[model samples]
Target chain A: MITGMDRLAAAIQGKKSDRIPVFCNLIDQGAKELGMPLKEYYSNGENVAEAQLKMRERFGYDNVWSLFYVGKEAELLGCKELIYAKDGPPNVADFVIKTHDDIHRLEVPDDISAHPAFQETLKCLRILKSEVGGKQAICAYVTASMTLPALLMGMDRWMELFMLGPASVRDELLEKCSDFFRKEITAYRNAGADVCVYANAFGSTDFVPMRLFRELSLPQMEKDLKPVGIDGVVYYCGGARMNAVLEQVIDRLGIGAYYLSPLDNISEGKKIIGNRALTCGVINDIMLIGWTMQEVRDEVRRMLDAGMPGGKFLFGTLVMPYNIPEENIRAMLETAYEYGACVEEATS
Target chain B: MLEDVITAYNEAVFDTDRERALKVIHDAVDRGVSPEDVVFKVVIPAIEQMIKSISESFDANLAQHFMTSQIAAEVTEEMLARFRKAPEVVGHIVIGTAQGDLHSLGKRIVIGCLKSLMIDVTDLGVNVPPEKFVDEAVARNAQVIGISAMMVHTARGENGCIMVRELLRKRGLEDRIKIIVGGAPYRYDLELYKTVGADASADDGITAGRVIAGLIKEVRR
Candidate 1:
């Protein structure tokens, strides 16, 4: 039988796996669960990587995200100038885009050797690729480009553009952001990441409306995803009701997996995407934030039952937080190990 | 006529295509829509639609998320500019980034929603100390102050509370205005806000808007 790691790499690449993969979004529980100090992990990349390696070795989960989240991408962009936050990733300097003119003047960054966080991300991936990527799979993380301009340009006047100008102009901004991510994704894959994770932490269920989904996000995702080819996980924020949108994304673009938090009605999603895409994540983050080991085990059991009847189902928490307790994480991994053992797929 | 405008506005807003929205607003106005009708009927509904879209569909892509939002903000300002009548109550609210937090998305959404309510909003942008919010409230004689933080760690936000206390101590204007907080980090409850000694806390803009309106009314009464 193929090992869980081999299975995950296969399923992610649309190949066959031995059994289901025990997915662990360790980035969520890195600070607390792994016993790494958040301040130190944020300050020093080597410490952060060491901490991540510790969690992977300790938990023995199938995967590990290179860093806390995609703040590194924002750091790569020139928008994060006032970054004195050495304790963590550099944050957007100030949300003052100054004027509409600032939007046009801003250029999406692409030079990776010069991008500090991108370089750090690549370095970590390189080390991991040598250490673990072949053993399992390594997901290289990048943030959405348009998200930053809004962060940098300020949301207020940027919104006004929809009312004030031609749609083509806004389209231009979306295009530039897409180009930056595509380039970065290529760089990461070339550097030896097994998969690339398209992460947008701000994309929540109640966050943005639907039409923008079709025009702006979907198009950009489709465009960049084509180059990413087969091995990419579309890690989106949750809006469980937007099943139609999710189905459309998988149908329009050949996404390898969908990593979401709330699985409010995942059975329905399983039917919607069929075997075309793998399903990842459903355990609620709040449960792990304060639950005991037993409680965490129960939640994992519940999600595995609800989400993993079929072969392509990977086990993950609802969402990972950087501050969840270690015992909770231990429970989560142990539960997956116990229940995920050689399950027969209900799939015919 | 207003109903028709609202329907069209709501339908088109989700697309995040401001051009279609511009056409809808102009059409509503050409039909002799009042500025109030245009804003409340045509613009706000579209804004709400766009907001819903951002939350659901386009959210995974932060670039689209911000692009759609920026378009929403520019649209709000443009629509308001067309209104010549003295706004019924050009209510003023001072908004800012909480101390030690620099995220600007939630705060911008709040300001946009308030402006659609025809309330004049004063956004201090990001990373402003809590003192700045209070000072702006005092100078503008602003009726309300809004602070937002997306960071989870409480220590940073505790600094924001200190800024508020310092503001009151220096200006003696503690009773003159109400303070509100919102953002992703505000998970536990409104008590976190109360614990911060804020008048209220909310995660989303609509709730914040309704609560602000209610608080303003109570203060006036």
Candidate 2:
């Protein structure tokens, strides 16, 4: 019997694993169900380690990330943070480093490890690596440069600039953000992250046009992520098709995975880039949003049936489902454990 | 530039040289083009086309919604700049994004379209405290107060209007300043606009402009 981590490693490495890898992200609710507070888990290394173990044991998923989000980053970055009580994601206070002139004020850290968020991610990754090392893959969660800068600039005003900034202004800001992420990725890898997952929130055209999208964002991965051998995964919540043009992206960088996104033409996406690197994710939202236990099993089974035909599959959402029902989450974990293993090739 | 702008706008649905597209309107207005005709035939249908596109899974890398918004803002600002130099348009409207919300794209779009048509617009940027909305409405003597919400969670912030009405304690003035609401989230529940104490709401800029134009005409009469 293969362990979950070993199975996931086999899958990413394109080898025969016992089962498919279950690598879904976690939210605070799942942690509290096991007696960990969201805030404490973030700051206290012991609490974070406990929560990571609980997530692994309960869900039986393959990878446990160093759970770093923008909130802690915001708090650590001298931004006002609104702490929520038992509900909602904690929010950053209203302060922005808006405009091109403000860009000059943007500080790229010296040695980068000095940032609290970076420190926390490193500490959490060390614990996860110690606990899950060689057993399952450990991911260091990182935001895309375009997104981190936008948040730091204040989400509202940054959004306004998307409509206002010229190609040059947008590129400049994205580059700064990219620079920040790249610096952090190297830092994250040093702290024990096997792969740094890049979460780019705004590449969706539901809000931005493609021209600026390409100019401002497309080349960021390679320029920023390549130096550390850091494998990149672009994860956005609602699917956006612009991501499919990996020819330009992958040519410049090492893109290891694409999270489950409806925007990508999964079949075509697999055909285009799956042969080049590890291709994972295609779990549907309906399965996790409001489906029954059997229905959830059937959904994962369906993805396994449909998406796994060519190989290199990782099981999960495109964007991690925040505040998902724990029952459904556990049901998903069970489904992955029960059915996600690899088999002999027809005994040829 | 025009060709790329059109392709980007048409392809993404949200892409348009709002400045150039609205130029057609401003030019028409400059040469005595009927505001109603320019709006109904040109701007209305075009933006409606865009509204349809955004409604159909628009993306920044794949679709051009935000840039379209930028164009809209520039066109609106240009028109407003031009309009300030001209004769009074005899209309005043206040606009804002609801509280606990900072998205200004949709509001900026609506404000831009109104400004291009030579209407007066006072934009209260995102996460506006309700008192400020009411305060701005009273101070501007706005004929209509417009509110926009883009996300489902942010729609909860529309509770600011009820706060405004209650804080003012005058349904007459509150009613006089007709509250208008619009955005992606509001599309599902038209009554949400009403529930938030808005007198009217439209899902897109065209209908919203038309609604405001009519409201202003009525107030002027």
Candidate 3:
């Protein structure tokens, strides 16, 4: 029997699989499913790991991607104002860098692995590796470099820097952000992750226009990601043109797979991505939560029909909504497995 | 002269030349360009051009957009200071992103729209508490309070839109102050308005401004 990891690896490498591996960029949904308060789940690695595994089992997810939230790496770097709430991921409470001069004092710890949040994430990866290991692909997550800076400075201030700051200042920040992410990717790879998923939400044309994405977001991402020898996937949300951006990242930057949002047409995305990389998704997170099970099943069948004919497709969601029902999630998975099954390649 | 200033402002901002953009605005004002005309004819057009380009799929780079917004914001402040009587206020509104949500790109865009429409807008900034929104609206005697929550948790969380609605009622100002909720969360489901007890919701700034105008009238009547 081919394991889920084998199937996913095969799909990513442009080989055939027996079925489309169905999972999601599921993190907080795990806590929501287990009825665990997000505050409790995010506070410790063991708790987060257990909740994720339980969610996978309950939802029949083929693979497990573990992440705490968007700003964990920043929190680890001595950002003091981390906000912990009742049932959602913690936010960077107050900005660490308030002025342009503060950029000079920014430092990356020599021993990143020693930071408590980093340690907790590694602990979660280790737990998942020990528990699921070869059976499920243990994917590690990191926020993309272009966006990680906003974790230290707020998003508005970061946008101000990108918009109004000097080119030298912007480049310096990009270099620092990329370097920190390099440390994060290295830590995740060293800790036994099967794949490292880099999230670049700002790269989407929805926020930063395509020109800035190409000039600022892309180069920084390529510089940071090119050194990582581990298999990598990208997550981006934007308008329809995002498919073209995904192609550049895969072809130019060497990412192996992409998790797309609903804004891009999957059929067009598959055509653009072709055999170069694996593609996993096109669901609107809002629809995942707001739509009924029947609506979920119908959309699942439609997406499966559109993408499963070719290789390198996985059934997934853009982002899982926090309040999404287990029944709706189960409906998505059931429909995918039933409708998304592919022909198994003959073994030697 | 208005056309010349608009073109100069457009090219200056698009080129990301903040100094040149500010110089043109000051020069315009020095040359007998009323502050209101500079706003309506030059600055507003420049910002509108950027927004139009973005919608048309032209790559109006992020920096240029922010730079143009900053110029427009500064000009709006100047216009309010110099000519409060020129453009009659359409309505008074208090706006901000909800508590626990620090993202403000959406709120800023909406603020720009409201300011351009000559509505008196007082921004409460990001991570604003629900009661703070009510208190600000009451202080300003504003007819509308527009709250933004971009993500799921912030849109529906305990201290989010739900909290804002209950707080407004608790303060006995629910009927007087209409709520217009927006951002990514409400764009997908207008039903969120009913859930959050907002009088209206809009997906974009122009629609938001128009909707808030109508909402103000409904509240006053």
Query: Which digits, one per residue and each the tens of the lDDT, describe model 3 over residues A1-348?
Result: 777787787777656777778766678766665677877777788888888888777766667766788767777666866776665667778777887777887887766677766878878888999988988878776777788877888777787777777878877877887888888877777787777767666767656656667777777777877776536555554322367576667766776677776766788888877776777766766767778899989988888777765678887675576778768877888888888777444222
Sliding window of 10 residues with minimal summed lDDT for model 2 chain B: B58-67
lDDT scores for all predictions?
0.62, 0.60, 0.75
Model 1 Cα lDDT, one tens digit per residue, A1-348:
344468775554444454567767666344554455555555555555666677778888777666545455555555455443322333555543565465576666666655665666666666777777677667666656545455555444455453345567676766776777777777777877666666643333333455556555666666766765746556555323335466667767666677754634577766666677777756665446557787778877777776666656776653455556767777878887787666554463
Better of 1 and 2 by TM-score: 1
Question: Looking at candidate 1, what is the lDDT of residue A93?
Answer: 58
Q: Write the per-residue lDDT of candidate 2 for residues A23-58, one digit (tens) a residue.
A: 776645444755656565455655666677776777
State which candidate, 2 or 3, has the greater DockQ: 3
RMSD to true structure for each model, in Å: 5.3, 6.1, 3.3
Q: Which candidate leads the pack in lDDT?
A: 3
| Global Cα lDDT for candidate 2 | 0.60
Q: Write the per-residue lDDT of candidate 3 for residues B1-221, one digit (tens) a residue.
A: 98898898888877767788889989988999998788878876666676566667675544555566666777778776898586767789999988888878767766766676678899999889988988889999999998888777888887877887898888788889988888777866668778777788876654566678788888878
Q: What is the lDDT of residue A243 in candidate 3?
A: 71
Give the higher-TM-score candidate: 2 or 3.
Answer: 3
Q: Of the candidates shown, which would achieve the greatest TM-score relative to the real structure? A: 3
**Deviation of model 3 at A108, angstroms:** 0.4
- Where's the lowest-lDDT run of ten residues in candidate 3 chain A? A232-241
Using TM-score, rank the candidates from best to worst.
3, 1, 2
